[model samples]
Target: MIVAGSPAAWLDRAGYHRIDSPSFDLSMDSGFILDGEVYPGGDLTIREARALRFVVP
Candidate 1:
């Protein structure tokens, strides 16, 4: 789960769960696949951004 947002965005440290995803290993820079969701703690400036940048690990 590669989340790219503003530097001010506070990432939820509560943690997340894992779900069954077939396309998991197909990615390069796959951070952590969360079966659940992440609630942003801070205000995200790029809330309306549609572009997603991923790192192929």
Candidate 2:
């Protein structure tokens, strides 16, 4: 399962120093396809800003 305050915070907290490319892969067998919601550990306003930067455009 993936959990973090935000995408950026997740990356920061997870120690992702650099993202060479703006893409990732998700295996089909991964669980929780539609079973849960992501909760940010910080303030709501800042969460989205931090998270969106990590998403590939």
Candidate 3:
């Protein structure tokens, strides 16, 4: 996943290190499971999977 800004640029603004990973899973205490993903942190908010259509494309 591409960060909105570069790591150095993000660090300058947010003052935190960026974590990058290719794949991971997130399991909640309620037993919710998210699988087969990149950017697990960003994916955590997904409640369901759906196709995204872009008119410009």
Best by TM-score: 3
Task: Output the lDDT of residue 28, model 2.
Answer: 39
> All candidates' TM-scores?
0.16, 0.20, 0.31
Candidate 3 residues 1-56, lDDT tens each? 23574656656666666666554565444433347443423234424446798799
RMSD of each: 17.3, 14.0, 9.3
Give the TM-score (vs. native) of candidate 3.
0.31
TM-score of 1: 0.16
Candidate 1 worst ten-residue window by lDDT = 40-49
Q: Candidate 3 — worst ten consecutive residues by lDDT sum?
A: 37-46
Ranking by TM-score: 3, 2, 1
If both were scored by lDDT, which would come out higher, candidate 2 or candidate 3?
A: 3
lDDT of 1 by residue, 1-57 (tens): 324432332334534433444332232333443467644333222223457999999
lDDT (tens digit, per residue) of candidate 2 on 1-57 = 233334566676777665344444443333232347644333222212235345576
- Give the Cα lDDT of each candidate: 0.40, 0.43, 0.51
Q: How many backbone clashes does candidate 1 have?
A: 6
